[model samples]
Target: MKSILLCFGLLFISFLSPDISAVRADYRSASENQEEAEKLYTELASVSDTDEVLLLGYKGATATLMAKYAKGVSAKTAYFKEGKGLIEQAISTAPDNIELRYIRLSVQENAPKIVRYHKEIDEDKQFILDHYPNLKDGETKKYIKGFVSQSASFSEAEKQLF
Candidate 1:
């Protein structure tokens, strides 16, 4: 009877272990980082091109950091969307900027596992094909093909631009 009581006490203690506290702390940090990233994104959006190119670079870096944290939290879908939007906006303001394209591709490559928006992907592919179609086929292209084939949205879009 004493052994049984001791065993129950140990089990209860294990259930209230420190690991849970550490996990909660990690979650809180991720949440705080996400909020900071959102703020930086908002500030970047409001800034004009008259600002130094370095400012845009800083914003992109901040966005990427936020995305990394979001991915860690398994909130990747939201992170990718937000990161993509920020990069796209920056690119539009600085069309000749090569760094923007690299940042955009980085976000795309790291995008979390989710239902692919086939229409949007297809439009991007077609645009590339129309201009740089001659580019050699690669693994990324193959993966995208598979995604489009599997995605229901791809079928529903039926050539419509996303």
Candidate 2:
């Protein structure tokens, strides 16, 4: 019986082990840890388990961040354009993915006005508001709620939903 119990415990741990290292949570700390962003992006790009759309979105986000650190105009332009292209593909692949929309929203909020990347800001916000309640992941809902609470883009009533 003890051996059987040990086997079950090991199985349980194994089941949870993948989630511990999945790409979904891997990039969540990128904002706070920019130094690791490039490595994380490289590692994530090599992963096949994650949804391709989500992976592409994060890859684009990472490229955008890298663009900020680029030393030359040509390098910066290349990274930014590549990132934008990857994000556009992700959006096209999963138009209704709220998480992807949130990623895009965050990007647009901080992007320069001259870039004209704000076109989807309102649409993404509305989509997030409408779909937030239906999200199944409690942790993600909490993250979104925290984000909304501090975001200038969301109105008072809109923040109340999260």
In order, the Cα lDDT scores of the candidates are: 0.46, 0.74
Provide TM-scores for the models: 0.35, 0.77
Report the alpha-carbon TM-score of model 1 versus the true structure.
0.35
RMSD of each: 17.6, 5.4
35-140: candidate 1 lDDT, tens digit per residue? 6555555555544445544355435545555666654545755655554555566767865443344334434434445524222344443443343323253533
For candidate 2, what's the RMSD?
5.4
Q: Which stretches of candidate 1 lie over 4 Å from their true place?
A: 1-50, 57-61, 71-78, 113-162
Residue 162, candidate 1: C-alpha displacement in angstroms:
34
Worst 10 residues of 2 by lDDT: 15-24
